[model samples]
Target: MTRSANEYLKRILLSPVYDVAVNSDLQKLDKLSASLGNDIWLKREDQQPVKSFKLRGAYNKICQLSDAQLAKGLVASSAGNHAQGVAYSAKKKGVKATIVMPATAPDIKVEAVRNFGGEFVDVVLHGTSFEQAKEEALRLSKEFGYTMVAPFDDEDVIVGQGTIARELLEQNPDLDTLFIAVGGGGLISGISVFLKQLKPDLKIIAVESDESACLQAAMLAGKPVPLEHVGIFADGVAVKIIGEEPFRLCQQYVDEVITVNTDEICAAIKDIFDDTRVIAEPAGALSIAGIRKYLRTNPMQGKKFGGILCGANINFHTLRYVSERCELGEQKEAVIAVKIPERKGAFRAFCELLGGRAITEFNYRYSTDREAHIFVGIKLREGRQELAQLTESLGSNGYNSFDLSENEMAKLHVRYMVGGRPPSLLNEKLFSFEFPEYPGALMKFLDTLGERWNITLFHYRNHGAAEGLVLAGFDIQDTERGEFDQHLAKLGYIYQEQTDNPAYKFFLSDVNGVFEK
Candidate 1:
């Protein structure tokens, strides 16, 4: 059913969501503003009691329920935040509810649903995916006369999410552009409809994940369509299809829809942490990611921009993945595979040619007699342009290199597997060293010892810590061990010999593989 502009506005204004959800701050992101050359504000939806804006719509829908309908109980299907929203609302209303979550839902979220609802909500672990759980929820709703509280499809829920726009204008009326993350479209639909009607000149931009861009697909088709597959990274907004009503409202009011990749989302997460000290989930950071991408192409200045930090219910392990990709996403890091000469001082010369650029990672092994391919990760000062210039420098220096910055396979799997068995045994000794992370640390290490030894294997990675770590293998005769110890003592860096480390012997070293009777 199509809702009139005034109808949505009146409903949003009259929404009783304040009974539960707080008026989250529209805080200014000073750091982001200075960096982006724009006045940036983040609507703090993550401040909600359930740590997400989902509670607003869920509670609003539950409030508008008839007394008779409340007696029949409520049912809803969600994989994460929305389930918690419905559970929170149901518990507050003292009504019986059944939340159908996918069997594969994280244990933390499943327990949270039970904890939030207490005895009021019954949780059913249904199928492997949201679609399967949703099917089961629908069946229960039809068969047992339970009312379905959809995540984003219904009118009351849309009005609930729309109230964000009401508070946004009140907090910052001078905003030139607003960025809202889109999933099933209820959030953007409500915001766009209300904001566009009241402030016709206000630009409403919709942000979406590239993996499951249902709204973009809907816009192309002029209707809501199901995606063939949806990525689970941004699970909060991983709706396979755009809701029918949301598509209608968005088609009319949204100025533009932009999609961002996984790396950009990770970068946005880090940006939010840097400015607000809040680690947002992937979906929560979508608005900020979109804003950055839009400004990159449009290149505007001194304009006010607002984005919704929609949720902060992040799984802790996900932070590991976020940290690894954030630099690449911001174009501040580049990964490459380069073939350098296999000689005693080749690595030292290569480091000298880098002109003081810090390497984030390096991995190599003794492979060929003449040349060896090394995987390298370097921190960039000027993003892609700097990377291009570095590549040119490598080529000019007679080193063949392939940029693996954009290679998923290279980033995910191959980087860790860069070390393997050498073609033959070469009196090698493995050692791990720790040096204070400071200016010219790499050069200090190279100058201290590398020129005197033939380095057979090397692995180094920076983890943003106070110390830099390196695992190095050197081709040294048994008689040089005492001299090597003296050189190491003069270097004044902490070192540990790892020649007998079991894991290295089991996987990386071939001393056990080379057979001799």
Candidate 2:
């Protein structure tokens, strides 16, 4: 090991994190272990006072600060758990803290920061993301002469997070593999450094959300690089770039980095609840999701594997979306788009083909004169392979079907906008829109559009996040197209015209008949 690696390991061994952070449990997940045919364990960092592992690093760093630095107070930027950690640590140290958080952060987290710090911390809601909030925090630190505490990247913070590795080794020394979620790479970097030093053969699998796999991208580029965009469903780990120090450590010690989709993360959350009766945040559940994915292709029967349940600070409102996607994530639900004849008994015949299988969702609309398109979701009691066999059976029975389980557009938008375009609609345009989600936001949107143009089709669904997605169609004369464009521009909502989207053409367009086999 390098000198820096040795220093990190030593710091972890002597970390003062236990002053404020508990030694979280390392409990066996019996249900998951039995199902996967492996001995699964959960490192329950979610059980911490702040409900996240971030407290370990935050408290350790704060406790180590010089008396002069503490007297000047502290400043940091974070959207959720990190903010809470800093706030809690500052309160414990009797130091004033200023936390800059994204304005779009969940209300639960913003309130938690206030509760943790009480009179010792000031909460500043600024910008739309953590990066923007970080800039604001830096400015505040300069203005107030406060010490800036980084959420990750600093040696002290990395060493503090490494404490988990020490506990894991002491708790279960014979584990074959450990799955750790990566964000800015702090947790995994710290843990991998310590674990690899102690047990050279132990596999350290770094897990990340597919939408925000910055560490994976960094590894591929051989250096840290920023991602242009990242999904915020797993907002806790939605870092656009990995920290340089953490990246270096991960490169040297991490055995592999893998990404999991949103559905898989939700399913993992469900799995955790099934075993422990605790619901973990999407990022927290990512490690178990990675383990589940790995076991599918590489079944290691009876081998001991560990996963970190890094946090449990989930927004209560987001549970609806998590529950809805968990089934699909577990491959226990299959969404399909099908074409059927426009006769009276077509629906009955379609049900007969399903052969008593539970129908989760069914949406249909008559588009053309001779055929109709139906968006259906089937409950898969047998497993993922059953969907393929069912689709094949439908095709052999003369029903044209399209598997939409993996279609992003279908899952996010098209399924909700199933009504066919009207033949009488002339010069019609279809558009998908995204806007900040709040009460009456939809009404405000409609008011901005005015009553000038006829609305041909409209669809909206709330996923209980910061933003709302909408699909709409409008009928306007070519002469009035310029006015429509002006209205769209003035509305200030993010939108993309989807009149030519393939999914729309397949399911909603009047000109396109049932797809040819």
Candidate 3:
């Protein structure tokens, strides 16, 4: 008998399937490539009517089956893409396809399978995850006399997926790299084999979301290893363990594997829409995100590379989060925690410091003492650093501050609560400054705000040292210039006019153009 490994390689090499699963026309992505600062192309597997590259493997595998096997029908399990592929392929081959999908699978996916004439068995959604659904599917396939079509582990499936590499090379003979999203590693395995045979110099990079980096983790362990936990954020590539065969093929033919965080993948999704006007599910854009990250760190410069936008089966609601998080990842946004003493004039004084920034969220936390924590979400200026220096200026006058950007739970919940007693006295001053970010920016500001005024409210967090937003309030007996502008000017910090309008009420009924209470 032919070695399964060799047979798989030959079968994929001879797949009578589409001459190529990924073509050059489909490979080029103007939007995806431009972000890389290189000539990058996208193998548009998402363009498939089924909305994924899964069809390549599904059809190729089924076509190679004997007539008797086809007559016996096929059984498969999938949450989305693979299910669509098997259903579509079975309909094309005039075979019955029974798909066992968890009740939790997206309704859209179930509909698509039904549209392709695949019978759906809605199983008990008792399992904690999709992999459990597959286990049930496997047991049912055996009981029902149905041949199982493994999504990415089977030799036939790998060969079919390899067809993508064959076509990609044919389209761009000069292409130096190919980025494929890894789940069970079938796509990478097939492409690695074909690409290495045709072009030994081609760099095959596998992109996997960190949550489901089964193949990458396996390679690291030198064997298939299951994840104790997996994040379903990118469902398509969320495999617990990479198939043993695919792993061996990967160890032999794959060049490199990389993982991307969910945030990074979300950023890439927005980037793709900005370029291609197309929305890709997180899993579909995994390779594109990886390639973008690679070129960002490696500088492809004038080289040509290819990324596969493999699927578009995203749930519509996820796009909202993907867009919002992408903006945050780009540093165009931030949520801040502001500390202010419970004082009358302090709130108004701090309001004056917000010049160019737009407020997005404002919440107050209640406290028994005179001081309280204020959570505020604000748009950051293009080039701002940590908030400490700004807080230092306020601190000198009596304000102490800390950043909540690193506190995930605070950003999620605490940011919305605002509680504190009303101030009875009014003695505070407010001012905004642009200061040089240095080793002692905060301490210097503290010295400058002087020891006379007690700080009431303060908000500043450094992202880097270039520049930062400073919102602070000080309890000063008088509104005289004193060391206010002097210290700022000495440090090359500018006193910026923030709020001068008559419509907004001042926290401190101060007595000046920019301050007094």
Candidate 4:
């Protein structure tokens, strides 16, 4: 549909989202502004009734429903925030709501949905993915006559989200730029459409988690397309494809779309906590991450900048992972694997060569008396520059080193598991797999992957997300290569071969004749 920006503007002005949703404060980030040398402001959408701006869209969509439609009730599917929004809105309108959430949806979110709706909503734990849960919701809406309240694709929903833009302009009429987090694109579509229409020169930059940048993909493809793979660390914005309407609106109004990695999101999360004492979910902090990135390249002085803390429904355990990686995101730490001699005092000599720089981490397990591979982390004062200098310094001193700071596999799997060299060459093939996180998922994976092959090495970590990331190794003979290929094809999970990955070669696997072990 060709969305009329003016119509959205009119509806936004008249939106009744405030009935259940609060007009969250437009707070100034005094500390962030001072530190970044820019006037940064954050719209506290995390302060909404459901702790998300999603409540606005859900409530508005419900309000637009006719009395008969309301009586028929509504059905919606979401991994988190939208489910709570629909449930809360349904309760306010005295209508029944069936919220279908993936089985892997955060327990806190599921419980919050039930609490907000009281007896007015039924929480159905559906399939392992949003797509599956969404399919069930659609089936129920069609066959059972429930009104389907789309999470981000409907007109009333767009109007509801546009209310944020209305509030933003009102709060800071002279705001120079706005950074918005894009998932399905509803939030940015509404905000960008409204802001661009009102202030033609207002810059609207969309931010996305690099793992699931469906909007950025849409901008490239010129249409919404599904991403073959998507990471879910920032589950809130982990959409595989942008909504059709959202994509259309974004194509018209969005000036630029930038993607941030998990580390950057973690850094932004810390920045938000430091300034506002508010713990933003990974997706909630994307705007701040994007703002920092934009300023790094397009340096500005005292420019009025605005961003939204879209939600704060963070899983508690996730804070641990965030704490560990945030320093890397800020370029305050660098990890490198170095080859040091196994001779006595070799470790001490390496540390001394650094001139007493603080060591953040060091991992080494003696495998051979000839040489050793040491995984080391050191603080950085000049970010990547310092890292380059350190690497060069190590090379000049006859120490071979590899920078694994930007290597995803190294940071995620190898760092924690630095000591697992096969006893002998077992013809092992390493693979990194991503699968839906649910009960028995690991066992199921083992069942399918290890039934015919000998398991060699395995590493898995859960960051309180919808998916589990596993790095597994299997021993396969050359004669079984065809069968192994067939097995991998039969397994539908997303995966990438890591046999040649430097992290694995240096730390986990039996490589070369020398055994970098």
Count of backbone clashes, every candidate in sequence = 0, 0, 28, 0
The 10 consecutive residues of candidate 3 with the worst lDDT sum are 501-510
Candidate 2: 10-residue stretch with minimal lDDT? 508-517
Model 2 per-residue lDDT tens digits across residues 1-517? 3448788888899999888889889999999999899999999998899999999989988988999999999999999999999999999889999999887788999999999999999999887667889999999989989999898888788888999999999999999999999999889999999999999999999999998999999999999999977776898899999999999999999988889998899899999999999999999999999999989878679899999999999989889889978999999998988889999999999999998999999999886578888989999987778988998999999888878777666787787777756665367688888765556878977887688889877888877676677888888788898988998998877787877766676786655663533
- Candidate 3 or 2, higher TM-score: 2
Residue 7, candidate 2: C-alpha displacement in angstroms: 0.5
lDDT of each: 0.86, 0.88, 0.68, 0.89
Kindly provide the TM-score of model 2 when superposed on the true structure, using C-alpha atoms.
Answer: 0.92
After TM-score superposition, what is the CA distance of residue 431 in candidate 4 from its true location, in Å?
Answer: 0.4
Give a tens-digit lDDT track for model 4, residues 140-184. 999989999998988889889989998888889999889999999
Question: In model 2, where do residues sit more than 4 Å from their true spots?
Answer: 1-3, 425-458, 472-502, 514-517
Better of 2 and 4 by lDDT: 4
Expressed as tens digits, the lDDT of each residue in 238-294 for candidate 1 is 888999998989989999999998889999999999989999989999999999999
Task: State in Å the error of residue 515, model 2.
Answer: 2.9
TM-scores of all candidate predictions against the true structure? 0.81, 0.92, 0.72, 0.97
Top-lDDT structure, candidate number: 4
Model 4, global lDDT: 0.89
